[model samples]
Target: MVHYLYLHGFASSPQSAKAQDLGDRFSRLNLSLNIPDLNQGDFSHLTLTRQIQQVSTLFPPGEAVRLIGSSFGGLTSAWLGEKYPQVERLVLLAPAFGFLEHWLPQIGEVQLRQWQQENYQAVYHYGEKRSLPLHYGFISDVRQYCELQLTRPVPTLILHGIEDRVIPIQASRDYQRDRPWVQLVELDSDHSLGNVLPEIGLAIQSFFSLK
Candidate 1:
């Protein structure tokens, strides 16, 4: 049996709109989509390496797996596909390609400096709807995983919003370039892609050849 999983974006959770929407779709199809909380209930200690390792444990041995990852989780899924041959396919939604490049600036130099000095900074968690302290190690740990090095040829499909100012559609465009195995679909929406979720669902269904 093929294992299906959904990995939510940074500061998001299993109850995210996109995750719930896709879960509902899978439910209607009599299929199950496993969504694990990458935060592990400790947002302050979260790291890219931790998230990747956490998801890796869910992969059943020798089982074909398909992943639907959003934003940061999309980045995680890409790396997983690279390292594990069992990850047969990937559907990335506004995947955070240049995560550090795009995210560090938004945090600002002063904030980053303070975070480095203090080892943690208050980050607004959209999932928890509250501010949580995030450690500097998050940025440092991610330095080792270069998305540019992800040249693994897995059957990948990326759904990115044309108006996404967060990660931007250009990130997906760059990822799809020179990677004949990867396909990108631009949606008319912003970073949240809330407006185009139904369209996204249909595209995912088509990508996986789902009925």
Candidate 2:
């Protein structure tokens, strides 16, 4: 059986709206979807490296795995797909490629400096009322995996929103350039893509034709 792993974005959890919706939809088709909490209960030390390690341990080294990632998770998928030949295919939703470069400016140099000095940064989570602590280590750690590569052409599909301010659609467009293996679908939505999830689900079904 092909394992379908769903990786959520930063500050998001396994119970994220997309993950839960997809889990139900996939289940109806008799597919098993694995949604792991990337933060592992300690958001302070979370990093791309640790996320990859967690996925590595969950999945056997040489087994076929299908990936569906969003935003930061999309970035994680890029690294995973490159390193692990077992990733048979991928579906990225508004992947956060080039995030580090854009992030510093969004936060401002002063804020970034403060975060680095304090070792933690507070950001409001989607479902939580209060802001959460995301350590500076998370930002520093992703720099290593910022560069994305696909070692071999695995069947890949990317869904990005044109109006996405968080991670610009142009990032996906630029990333897809010269990469014949990737097929990017531009949707009329925002960064979350929550409004058009049904359409996204249909696209996923058509892309993989999961049997």
Candidate 3:
């Protein structure tokens, strides 16, 4: 059996609009789309490693998996595909590649150092609709998963927005550049990708059908 799973982005939940929308689409086709809560109700101690482990537990023995992820979750999906043979196909929406390099500058030098010293940073959790103190360990744990090590030939499809200021479209470009197993599709929307769900849904149907 092929398990279809959706992993929501950072500071988000299974109830995110995109996740729900995709879930509904899958339901209409008589398929189950399991959207796991990556935060595990503990936003303060979140890390990429934990997300990977959590999702890995869902993969049944001798079963294949098709992963669909957004942003941070997309990054996690990539790593999952790299580590697990069960993950045969991936659909990534605005994945955050070169994460720390992009985020540290946005957090700024002063705040970054302060977060390290303070051991926590007040990050707004979109899923919770409030701010939570995310541990600095999130950074250290992520550094362990280098993008260069993601050489797995898992069939992947990346849908990124040209106007995604949150995570530049160039990130996806850089990721798919040397990877022949990956396909990149550019959209006119932004990181939210709310307006292009139909297109994404259609692309997913076609991609999954071809192979």
Go through the candidates in order and give each one's C-alpha lDDT. 0.92, 0.87, 0.93
lDDT of 2 by residue, 4-120 (tens): 899999888888888998999899999889999897878768899999888867776567989999999998888888888889899999998898876678899999999999998
For model 1, the stretches where C-alpha displacement exceeds 4 angstroms are: none
Q: Which residue pairs collide in model 2, if any? A: none
Error of 1 at 148 (Å): 2.1
The better-scoring model by lDDT among 1 and 2 is 1
lDDT of 3 by residue, 1-211 (tens): 8899999998899989899999989999889999988998788999999999999999999899999999999999999999999899999999989888878888899998999999999999898999999999999899888799999999999999999998999999999999999999999999999999999999998888822
In order of TM-score, best first, we have 1, 3, 2
Q: Give the TM-score of candidate 1.
A: 0.98
Q: Which residue pairs in model 1 clash with each other? A: none
For model 2, what is the C-alpha lDDT against the true structure? 0.87
